[model samples]
Target: METRKLGDSDLEVSAIGFGGWGIGGAPFWSTEGDNASVKAIRKAVDLGINFFDTAPVYGFGHSEELLGKTLKPVRDRVILASKCGLRWSREALGAISKNASRTSIEEEIEASLRRLATDRIDLYMVHWPDVHTPQQETLETLVDIQRKGKIRHIGVSNYSIDQMKEASRYGKFISLQPEYNLLSRSIEAEVVPWCLANGVGIVAYSPLASGVLTGKYDKATRFKDWRSKGVIGTFQGEAYERNIDKVERLKALADSAGRTAGQLAINWVLRQPGVATALVGVKNERQIEENVSAAGWAPAPEIDARLNEVFARE
Candidate 1:
């Protein structure tokens, strides 16, 4: 496996990282047990996946807990990244409203640390922006954590260009995690360019577009999730179908390159500038193996160009 520098930070991680969402098992498609998730995680680390990204809100802390127990033995060997900004109580799973107070940020970090069973986090990020909380206050909290050695690097996820710039004012943010893939290219217009110019690394999540890029779902297939029940997957029916077609076209390209569509999608994100790694979620060893192989080969220029063309049509 190859490692890349995250922004100007000294931390180097594999080109592909394991997104710990699926392993935590909630609000997503699959719900594997902690033991199964742990097995998959250990396999990933053995195969050279040194970076693992997770959030406290995921599975309402279940995700972090599982990662903590499974990766504790190799805690020092891998770079663990988790986020704050979203608050959750013992009863609920969503954020405690978009209000991120300095106190809340501190409390969340402390709680996450306990769950992850680590003394320090390699990269700590703000999971989402809080419209009610002052950006300065949040950034100040992050700076405080870094100074205390509780966190090595700072990052922001799902932030706009202006928000990222404002956060950068407090200190150097080493990375940014956002929903980015062939189906979700909205970040490319401004966020990506800003990160590249400022030397902020991009950790693209949902690189498979929640499995749409796997070419498994079609017009006949129905998703049983909030996303499908919401506007994007239902109201934009034709758009979804068109995206599927694009995935099929890309699948053909992947076949020629001797890779799966999922692998090609991961490689496409890796080829982009400022992308330190693509956080792919997996339930078993097969998925992990396929994703890791993307790091072994870079797609040809023509294949890359064709992917761009397909996305342009979307």
Candidate 2:
């Protein structure tokens, strides 16, 4: 697999990183079993994927636990990246809230370390923006942690350009993990340009638009989890139909390139400027194999232009 420097940091991760959101066993994502997830994680590493991304809130620590158990033997071989700042109460197990205060971050890091079974994290990130907590305070706490060698580098996820700038005052953000796919281009207008100019690498999550770009669904298709509840635009009624139509055309393009639609979608994101890696969520070994095929593959300029035209259409 291809490797890229994460922002300006010394850490160089694989172009295709394994995203642990699905393996976490969250009801919204659903899952098969721990054994299956374990097999998938091992398969990903064996296939040359050196970057693994997870979060404490993913299954409320379940994801980190699984990742830790599966990768502990190969810990030194992979770049372990996890996030903080999202917390849930014991009383309300599934209900999570953003809490990035100095105390909250300080406490969350300890728990994450314990769950991941590692003394130090290669890259630690603030999972979400907390409105009540100042960016300076949060970044300062991370800086202190990095100073202690508990974390190698600091990054942020789901942050706006202003927040990235504000956090950079306290510590240089090495990376930004955000949702960016063919269907979700909201970040391209500003966040992407700003990151590219400022030397912040982008780790694009949901590059397949939560599977909408895979050409696996149709009007009669319905997901078993909360995704079927229509909370996300791509999973909703009219938008779902529109996206499916686009995926069909995209599949044709993928066919000509001898790749699956999912691989094509991932390749599109990987080819974008400022993208260091594409974090793909996988459950079993087959899924990881399919996703890893996207690495280092770039479509022709004319094909890319046709893809843009498809996105441009209604």
Candidate 3:
């Protein structure tokens, strides 16, 4: 696997990292058990993936606990990145809103440490922006944590360009996690260019367009109730079906290049500048293997050009 420097920080991570959103047994999605998830994670490590990204909100803290147990033995061998800023209660399964209060952030970090069974997190991030709290207060708290050596580096997820600039004013932000894929190109307007200029690494999530680019779902396919509910279902409706046609066209390009559609999609994101790593969620060992193999193969220039043409038409 190829390794890239994480922005301006000293940390270097694999070009492809494993995301732990689906491993926590959350109510919103069907996921694997602890043993299965751990097996997948271990397989990823064996395949040379050194970066693992998770969050406290995933499975309402269950994801962190699972990650802690599975990766504890090889903690030093990998770069662990987790997030804060989402408020969760015992009765709730998802994050209520963005929160950056001193007490709240501290409590969340302590809990994450306990679950991760680590002395310090390699990359600690604010999962989302808190409209109520000033950025300075939140960033100062992060600075305090850095001084205490609780976190090695700081990052922000889902932050806009102006918000990122404000954050850089407080201290150095080494990374930013955002939703960037063939289906989602909004970040190209400003976020990608800004990160390139300012030297902030981008950890791209949903690089496969939530399985749409994997060539698994078609017009006749029916998703689970969890996928059909709320935003997930609404987003996967007609527009998604239409987008799948574009995916089908791209799959032909992948075939011509002798690569899978998923690999093609991931490589498209990895080819972009300022991308430190692309985070992928896997449910089984085969998925992990397929994703890791993509790193070894690069698409030809013609395939890359064709992919851009297809996306442009979309």
Give each model's whole-structure lDDT: 0.83, 0.89, 0.85
lDDT of 2 by residue, 81-133 (tens): 99989888862334778899999988989999999999999999999999899
Weakest 10 consecutive residues of candidate 1 by summed lDDT: 226-235
Tens digits of per-residue lDDT, candidate 1, 63-134, equal 899899888999999999999887655534333455467898888889999999999999998888898888
Q: What value does the lDDT take at residue 44 in candidate 3?
A: 95
Query: Number of the top candidate by TM-score?
Result: 2
Query: Could you tell me which residue pairs clash in candidate 3?
Result: none
Residue 165, candidate 2: Cα error in Å is 1.5
Q: Give lDDT: candidate 2, residue 96.
A: 74
Task: Give, for candidate 2, the lowest lDDT window spanning 10 residues.
Answer: 225-234
RMSD of candidates 1 onward, in order: 2.0, 1.7, 1.9
Model 3: C-alpha RMSD to truth? Answer: 1.9
